[model samples]
Target: MADSQLALFSALISLLRRLGKLDDNIVLAYTLERGKKLSMLSLFYVSNVILALFALSGMNIPMYNAMRRCVPIASLLLGPCIYPQRTTSSIIMAIILITAGTITAAQGDLDFDFKSYTFGSLSVLTQALYLLTLQRMGSDNKLGSYKTSSAKTLTILYVNSVNCLPIVFAVVFLSGEYNSMKSYPHWSEPGFLFALGVVTSFACVFSYSIFLCTTVNSALTTACVGVIKSALTTIIGMYTFGGVAATPLLIIGQLINLSGGSLYTYEKYRLQKPASPKPTKKNSSIRPRKPKFTKTARNSSKTTF
Candidate 1:
């Protein structure tokens, strides 16, 4: 673990210098200070990926998706313990609905295996932890005076990629995949390399799209898009993966699951947004009294009033 962390830190410095896109000093300082947190974050990330692979391999696409959709429920249950946020009734109801959908979907899973279900559930839990860690770690870490949201988002992407690399490489080597890849005859083929490059390029674009979305809109919008995208994927999975029986129960359950997830995101946003300071009765009542001053202040700042 120590070696992994050290390697990650070294790679981080190299990337920051090579890319010349992030503030190296700020990123390195944060990486060094929060070493333990990042290590734990990586653990969750690696675990989630491994478990998700197992879940995906063992389960059908639709069931796998349904199980993974429970991440929000896990987040709702676990988030307040760490960050102490307000949890509303609507949030709880949303979780309940999501849970019911998962259960209903499970009932319709003709090829269900307990191991796959368990692994999928575990993947969702670890993924929730990973996401929570990112939120907490990113939110608290200051990137100095010149930091923008885009910079912060890029910082996360860089740090995460670097931090996870050592462990990922270690896993691949230890699991014998490295050796297997080296022996694969077609790995050196141009078509294979071109396909790999195209996939890698798309992945980079996807990451940038996410960050750009945040810059163009807000985190809430990005998250809402994510929820909608998941729903679309689930729907597509049902059709694309012919093995999955499009039974009425399965369809209804997936719909319910998607609806619940969607509703949760929308409600979560609405509930949280209301917490921000708005014009209160007192502020409104005092507005007329300070009308001249308010007008002057607004004009001088030329900002939202």
Candidate 2:
């Protein structure tokens, strides 16, 4: 449903461009001599789509979310390796805390599936890479002239929608879902259609927000946002899903994760902060002196001259 909705949105945007209602330059910005940037954007979108599949694959929601808590740590570790950024002791400590919290949270779910764990780990890695790519793109001044962040986001969305169309169709065809749909005939159900629409709308908003966030902020900051999002999702799932429960360990883990994310955010902010300019010594020679008040001194000085 989400995939089809994005494809539809992309088609509409393309049609608008053809009709001269939208700017063609913005859509074609990445196509001109920016192969690396385009590849990153494609990877970002593909990994996210896969991540969504992993999340929806009947895994324990809280457990999956808890595993994703490692995103900040992964980004921090990969930062120096990928982008050669300096890491501080505070950041390392925060990463440790986050890891510990994730482990603690996972204790709540005793049934651990290896496939879900593998997918969750890949999702974290890909998400971190996506953020890193966005950071790199944002720092490149050359790309700045081509399009605004919003425009780049829209372009990426359009590309992703188009890119996934074939894969989605293939999956539907191979899985026999198309034939099953014809046999079951659920299209006429208003409730199901409405629910699907709501889900797709939410997914679109979420994807757009993520693109905007990564474009505007650093990868670490985006990871921090992910931490907050995961926490919220887990909390909501506890109430929305019957099997999900909030244990004491889970609560403690959440607090630890929040604290770690907050600490990392502060550390990153401090590191990136502009240094204050120092006060330079004033030149006494440049200042005009006050006039002498004593007449006798002035007269003596004139006589000597």
Candidate 3:
């Protein structure tokens, strides 16, 4: 267990660096437009690619392994759209939540296939970093022109989607899995069921929407959203798939995550009232500004005098 956590922590650190770099790049790209910026559009294109993978990957763990590779990139790409100012403590709390959730996920199937485990760890790490990046990007930074959503979306699409060509190539060349794309039913196919299910997308999309919202604390927003996604996914997976049972530990992890996020939210906004200055009476001669009408009449009387 300790070894797994250490591995995950290492991956998360790397993922955080990647995310920070991606966010910085977005800011840079806004300041200076380059041909490579065009490639970022691929981030959006990969949405289709991810969907295609789900269609053919079948109901198994390998597809998730494939998704793990993409998680970090996807999450980092989304950094620009989140709220601002991710504090160090908040980042730590987020790591704990995501890591706990992941540990819960890894409980069974001790097959210990190093490759699959590695990829899954990477994917979770990437996702956690992405959440942090969202916290970083959620702010309205007055310094950069690309601070807004239009610029952010464009930047991510260009960098992640277009730059994803290498990944696309690797997936196509390295794996026979992607070769028979025709084997999977297209969107037009009748009664086609998507692998991993729309629930995943729904949860993700909802989380992303929350990221874009004007919340008081970016960390709390992320934590709350993560908990919702993790809980819902677990519930659906346990109930529908009947593949795994929910462990008490997993429930406890969710509670802890929720508690952390709620605390942050309360801390960020609760003290904002400024104490109303205790309503102290000022003894100074300086008076409040008179009404505009009264001032105007006073000026006219002064002119007459």
Candidate 4:
């Protein structure tokens, strides 16, 4: 049901573009202009999503979130390749803390699975690559003509969405899921339609936010945002969801993860803030002495004359 819905959603976007309704999605033309330099971005994105879905199957909600907590670290490691930015000691420590938290939480998982962890790790690496590529494109001097961050993000989202169509279809076809819904016969059901629409809408919104944030901020910062959100989701899952052990360790772990992400965000903001110009020394005020009422300075010249 879900796979078929995804295929249908992709088809809808492609159809809109084919009808020239989505003039904003110039990814295909842009890709052509770039001589296919950006062809790998779609591949990386598709791999990232697919690996994430694979990871989700082997783990519960809390564990799933915990597994993805390492994305920030992955982004950091991969970031320098796209943009060589220096990392601060605080950021390094934060990454370590987040990794520790993830490990701690994973140890307490009630449904630990090696295959899930492996897939999640692959997803993290792929996501890091995708993010860095997208960020580089957004920050490219070639794209500096974009009027605003929103415009740049929109171009990225449109291109990525359109490019993802073929990849999504290929995956579905290979998995034999394109016809899965035919067997289930749930396509016309009201509940199925509603759920599909809701999921697809949220996914679109999520993709927009991802590109926008990644464009406005650094890839690492966007990854940190995800870590922070997932940390909250993990905390909520502990009590509400039966997938987790709900142990004190999990609480501590999420706290550490959350704090780490927050610290990274603060550090990034501080670094990006323009430094205040140093206060220049004010010129010493040299007030002229009031002319003496009985000035004697000219006496020598008058006497000489």
Candidate 5:
């Protein structure tokens, strides 16, 4: 578990450096900037609920299957509805890229394999929805200009938690997933509390925390995270389950997925111009003044007349 966390931390640092935040001073600048002042209790409760919900989802193989079956439909529907105000071309491009990436990632799974295919499709779909929702909600500037990042993060987290409450309750009461609550568990134990703790912590930092910090440019973050998660999950699954190793098709698909993600990110960056450097106000040079020869010129003109 500790090793996994270390690996994730390393990945996060690599990402930050890629985003041009390698220097300690740059990181410190952001750290010192004014941030959303959210109450600890509110953050705690919301995070707990969100983690519990994910744990609940992990417990139910059947429910996961159901979500996989139904989620793609929702994902397909999400493409058109997000940011109705944005240009049609941009929206369509997003849909195309996401769909392509999803299909590429899901190619290795069995035919009609809802668990793998749907999960990949649904992940991309939900991410699009989340970005659209944030855009509609008007971001840091839109929602009354009160530095809304904190509030927005809190709201999304809370809403996610509330949405999954029924699932949590169902798993707790109906499935009895945690009956052996005190089992001495390694990280591999299926229903262990500590495993949940570690996984939730990783999700919070890697998934939710990044979402909060990079809400506006989330497409880039999502693309990076998606590729990493998909590749890593495939590698882990292959080694653990002793399946057919990743084939040439899978490799090609991964390359395409990464390329599409890069395109989307490049397009977004091109759309948003970076801030220009502020002009310096201090001028050291002085201009020469016109000589006081007005009187001499007037006398000379009168004499000549």
Candidate 6:
């Protein structure tokens, strides 16, 4: 349902761009020309959709959320290999801390299901791949013609939505989620319609937010946000969902994860921070000097004057 709304919103934005109502950061003609890149991007979108599905399939929400904390670690590790980028020692330590913390948190919940764990692992893997792919595409020189970050973001969103729409619809049709809708007591209720509208609006906003975050910032930053989001979700779940007991281990694990993530963020920022400009040296050898006259020459000139 949310996917459908995002697709619609993306389509509307594309239409506005075509009509000159919105800035066309992406060249529509060149968009199709990058066939290889577009195909890779399509795969990334499909993997992301699968990641969400896998997360949903996990039985234990908190445990599943804990597992997601590993995404940053996965991204950091895989990024160096896939993107051929260098990784710092601080980042390595951060990954270790995050992994240990995630394990500690999951240890508190002994009732683990193999299927849920498997899916959760798959989610982490796919998420890392998705982030790496986005980073690659965003940094590609071929797309550098799009000046604004917003243009790149919107272009990616537009392409991803178009590619995923058919798969989304097919899944909805096959899932039979709406098979017994007519049998419901209030299938056509105004309240239901209102709720759906609200959800769709929120989903559109969420999709845009995600795009902005990923496009403007590094992939690691997005993964950090995901960790923070999961932490917030866990806290909210404890109050709203009930049965979500915060064990001592869970608290410790959450702190460790947050600390490690914070350290990683700070380290990354420090490393990427622009170097201070050096002061320019004055041309000491080319200084203007006053002309000097000998005492005899000065006296002769004075006498003549």
Give the TM-scores of the predictions, in the order they appear. 0.72, 0.78, 0.49, 0.81, 0.51, 0.81
> lDDT tens digits, residues 147-250, model 2?
57777666655665665566666766876767877787678899988887788778777877876676677777777768878887888887887456678888
Question: How far is 192's C-alpha from truth in model 3 (Å)?
Answer: 2.9
- The TM-score measured for candidate 2 stands at 0.78
RMSD of each: 11.1, 4.7, 13.0, 4.2, 11.6, 4.3
Off by over 4 Å in 3: 1-115, 128-147, 185-188, 193-224, 268-278, 281-305
Cα lDDT tens digits, model 1, 1-120, are 223333444565566666875454444434654445467766887788778877877887766766766676677677776534455687677667777777777787789898888888
Q: Flag clash pairs in model 5.
A: none
- Per-residue CA lDDT of candidate 6, range 215-293, in tens? 6676667777777678777667767865456789888888888877887888878988999999998998997988898
CA lDDT of each prediction against the hidden true structure: 0.65, 0.72, 0.43, 0.76, 0.44, 0.72
List residue ranges in candidate 1 displaced over 4 A: 1-16, 19-34, 142-146, 204-227, 268-305
Q: What tens digits encode model 5's per-residue C-alpha lDDT throughout 1-305?
A: 32233334445544675788653322211111122321222233333333334433433322222222222224335536553433235534643554454455445433334444334344434544554454444344321233346545544443343333344445455545455433535646666757666795766466456456445444334434354345445556556644334666555555555454455456656667787899999766977787776887878867542
* Model 5: worst 10 consecutive residues (lDDT sum): 26-35
Judged by lDDT relative to the true structure, which candidate is superior, 1 or 5?
1
Residue 297's lDDT in candidate 6: 75
Greater-TM-score candidate between 3 and 6: 6
Error of 5 at 275 (Å): 8.1
lDDT of 4 by residue, 1-305 (tens): 33444455456656777898755433232355442555677779889878887888877777888878888888887777776546899999888889889988877776778998899899889988988888888777353256567767766665566567667777778877667745878877999889978887777767778888887777877887888889888878878876677777777888889889888888888988999999998767977788664446666446552
lDDT of 3 by residue, 208-250 (tens): 3544542224434444444444545555665665534456654
Residue 209 error for model 1, in Å?
6.8
lDDT of 6: 0.72
**Candidate 2: where is the Cα deviation over 4 Å?**
29-37, 51-58, 141-144, 175-185, 268-297, 300-305
